[model samples]
Target: MSVKIILAGGGTGGHIFPAIAIANAIKKQQPDAEILFVGAKGRMEMEKVPQAGYEIKGIDIIGFNRSSLIKNIGLPFKLLRSFVQVRTIINQFKPDAVIGVGGYSSFPVLRFAQSKGIASFIHESNSFAGKANMMLGKKATKVFVASDGMEKFFPAQKIMITGNPVRASISLSSITKEEGLKYFGLETTKKTVLVVGGSLGAKSINEAIDAGLEEFEKNNLQLIWQTGKIYAEKAKTRAEGKFNVWVNEFISQMEHAYSAADVVISRAGAMAIAEICLVAKPAVFVPYPHAAEDHQTVNAKHLVEKHAGLMVKDNEAKEKLVSSIIALAKDEAKQNELKQHIAKLGVSDADTVIATEVLKLIKK
Candidate 1:
């Protein structure tokens, strides 16, 4: 019989895409391997996983509401119910291993699997780990972390630094810079800035661009702005035409955007940082301040401290994001320096490395 692996995690694309990549790796190693995904009901994973050609089961789960105490009243019941759901799913799937990629749903699935003495693995994508993954690290057979010095969060013996697995689109983008510009309907001669704040969008970054639209034109720069869902219409109305800007809710083909970009302004999420490094884009990160333990900032600081990138705090984004990126775009010297440094930090084959490691443990 082929090996059966259970994967869990996801609220955002950051967690879901990595989980899918690992699943694909396992499938490649053992074509007959049975893979299953567990995610929170109504979460992005519920839709994305199936689209990736894997089966996924949804559990009743949610995280604590830090901003609203009253919203957490149903927390205990939801958690308990999710555990019950996990138990049922695991018993039915009978997985040889469970892999978690850090999200609310991961807690229940891994916890239940650990209790049954089944092997469990964890992928901590952030430089600063989440509370759930830190707790799961104690018993997980292997813990895959994005950065080192994570002994503070997980068992030192179990931790393996694999870096974050980026999408194959970015890892294998062979399109030339000129072709990339053509893909975005922009001139190769004009300096271009790409703005991304993850799939849902970052208000601060969007507002920053909205505040500085005139400056970009004055600076003779073009923009390919991904305003996310929240500010799509708002940015569209604000940026309607003039032949120099492309504004949308999401850029479905991000590899092209990354390829076309001269400079990028974005949120400092782990996955975002990984892709930016892979593309070697000179960037200014505005960390999502509310991320657990301010990890977005921590992730950006890791690059900034190495002179690999720049950081503008969430509070400072509106005032500083556009101006900073514009400055870097105009200054070829600074852009080249940042590009060289950030490229040095890029781990382009992380997906293969992480997938290979997971298979190694199983093959043994």
Candidate 2:
């Protein structure tokens, strides 16, 4: 019999992309499997999941408003409504298993699945676990994690350290630096720096890069900048007529960007870190200060402690980011050292491993 599965969760690319990777891996192993995604209504996953060629159902849900208590007045009603929607989805789909990849929507779907005694799994990409995942972990059949020592968050017996599943386009990329530069209409001779601040973009990183555009030019460094939607117009205006820079709201083909870059500046989101590690590029991370439990900082610090990468705090990015990146770009020895160390941390087959395990357990 063909297996049916529901992959739930995703507010950001960090969650959505990994879920897609896992879904793809599952399809590769079980060609006849039917997969569906459950995400929060109007969230990025509602749009991104379909783009990845998977069907999805959206629940009316929102996370707590940490910055404002007034904004959370409707929280209970939303959660209650989402559980109702999840019940409808699960009853209609009758999935053989459910997987939560860490987002607000994942909670209702996974919680409902566990209540029904359907096989349920979770992928917690961060060292620091989310509150929803922690609660779900108790009843989860399995909990896949990016690193070791996750027993503190999930049941020790349920934890599996498979590492974060990096998008195949990156982990398996064969694009040459020259080919990548040509894709961006940049010169192969100039050193290139790739700047990415997640799918929503980073205001501090954007401001710093904007302020230091001339400095980058002075140092003969070029850039392939993914400004996200929020800063796209401002970045374009700042980069106008600059042959050394290519600025866009998003880079659909990030493999090219990774290949072209000699140095990288990025937010320390789990998926971003995984991709960067796979690409083995020298990177300077600026962790988003407001991430839940400040996990982004923990992610960056883990690498920095091992000398695999460098970091600048979010508030310091405007003053220190450009100079740090420029110095790293110019230092081939330092770059190579970082590349070697960081490459050691990359896991190329995590998707396959997670998929195989999920299928194996569910079949039993």
Candidate 3:
């Protein structure tokens, strides 16, 4: 019998990439599996999921506006409308299982699936579970988590410790440092620092790096900077005459960037941390201070406590992030120490693990 499934998530690369990884892994195991994706309308998943060759349906869904209650007036209506859409999709598709991968869309999809007594699963990629995921997890067939001790949020019996699924391009990348440098038109002899502020550029990190452009030259270093779309033009202008810097709004080839970097400065989102660990690179994390429940800080702290990575407060990034990354780049011993510790935490086959579990659940 053909296995039919629905994967839901999307707002950032963090949610979308892992969802895609799981989708790809399921297809690998069950070549005839029918998979569909549901995401919030006008979100990044609308574009990204299709690019990965999966058909995705975008419903009118938006997360709560935490900054402005006034803007949330129509939110209830949006939620109701999204639930209707979810019901229609579920009824038409009649999926054997529905998986929520963490996003606004996931909430409604999984909620409806559970209401109908269909098997529902969740992949909570963060160390701290989101309010929606915590609520849905009670009835979920399984709740896959990246970290241990997530029982406080989800039912203990249902929690499965499956690390965040990293994109296949990164986990299985064979790109050599020399090849990575050549791809970016940089010299292999110069140490490289890759700065990524997530899919949407981090304004503070961008400003800090902009202020420290000359420091790279002073230290004889090259840079591969992914500035996200918002800051691309200004970032490009800043790197205009600099031969040592390659600045872009987005990196379609992240594996190459990771391969070329001796050190990385990144926003400490769950997926970012997952990718950094799998790449086994020395890193300086600057957690986004405003993240829900300040989870990014918690994510970074876990690694720092284990000596797997170092962190700088988001507010302090301007004064500290670049300098910290530079110091790490120059300290070969510390870099190797971080590399080995982080590699120990890396889970290269999370997609397969999650896929296998899903199949097992379906069989039961």
Candidate 4:
């Protein structure tokens, strides 16, 4: 029988994309390996995982709400119910090992596997570990981290710095800059700015860019703006037919969008940071202020400290993001500095490394 693995995590693309990357790598090595994905019901993974050609079972899990205590009231019951669901899924899937990619949905899946004496693995993508991953790390056969110095979060012996697994679309893209621009129907002669606010829109980033569209025109820069679903309609209204601006709810061809860019304006989510590093673009990170323990800022600062990227705070983006990116684009020296430093951080083969580790720990 071929190796069977249960890959779990994801409410957003951040966790789902890496999980898919790891699964793909495993498939590359073990062509017959059976992969099952465990995700939260009604979450993005339910759609994304199946789209990636994996079978997924959704658990009735809910993450804790930091802002609304009332919304979290049913968390305990939901968690209990999810644990029952996890046990059932594992029993049927008969997975050789379980991989937790850091999200509430991953908790029950890994926990149930551990109870059965099954080897469990974890991949912590953030600079700061989540509480669930910390608890699971105690028994995780190995914990994959995106960066070093994570010994504080997991057992030092188990922490392996494999970096985050970026999408194949990004790592293996053959698209050239001009081709990328043409794919977006954007002009090649203009400097293109790719503005992204994760999967959900960043209200502050949206407002700032809406206020600064004129500045792009003033400086003769073209824009490839991803306003996310939240701000897409209003952004389309503000950016329509400027002859230089392309505003959309999402960029389906991210590789092209990355290729089309001269500079990026982005939120500093771990996956976003990984893709940016892979693309080697000079970026201005506006760290989402309310992320768990402000880890997004820490992720951005790691790049900023290495001179790989610039940062404007969530509160400060309105006044600084557009101008800062404009200034960085003009300075060839600074752009090269940021690109070289961030490029040094890219890990093109993280999924393979992680898959090798998983196979080793499973012992056939």
Better of 1 and 4 by lDDT: 4
| Model 1 per-residue lDDT tens digits across residues 1-364 | 7888899989988898878878877777689988999999998899889988999899999998888999999999999999989999999999888999888999999999999998899999899989988888999999988888999998899988888888777788898888888988888999999999997899999998999998999999999999878899989998876578988998878888988998999888898888898889999989999999989989989989999999999998877888898889999999999999999878876767777777778768
- Window of ten residues with lowest summed lDDT in model 2: 146-155
Number of clashing residue pairs, candidate 3: 0
> lDDT scores for all predictions?
0.89, 0.95, 0.95, 0.91
lDDT of 3 by residue, 302-358 (tens): 999999999999888889988898899999999999999999999999999999999
lDDT for predicted candidate 2 compared with the true structure:
0.95
Enumerate residue pairs that collide in model 1: none
Pull out the clashing pairs in model 4: none
TM-score, candidate 4, is: 0.98
Clash number for each model: 0, 0, 0, 0
Query: Listing every candidate in turn, what is its Cα RMSD in Å to the true structure after a full C-alpha superposition?
Result: 1.2, 0.8, 0.8, 1.0
Name model 2 segments beyond 4 Å from true.
none
The C-alpha stretches of model 1 lying farther than 4 A from their native spots are none
Model 1 weakest lDDT span, ten residues long: 348-357
- Can you write out model 2's per-residue Cα lDDT over 1-364, one digit (the tens) per residue? 9999999999999999999999999999999999999999999999988998999999999998888999999999999999999999999999999999988999999999999999999999998998899999999999999998888898999999999998998888899999999999999899999999998889999999999999989999999999989999999999999999999998989999999999999999999999999999999999999899999999999999989999999999889999999999999999999999999999999999999999999999
lDDT of 3: 0.95
- Candidate 4 wrongly placed segments (more than 4 Å): none
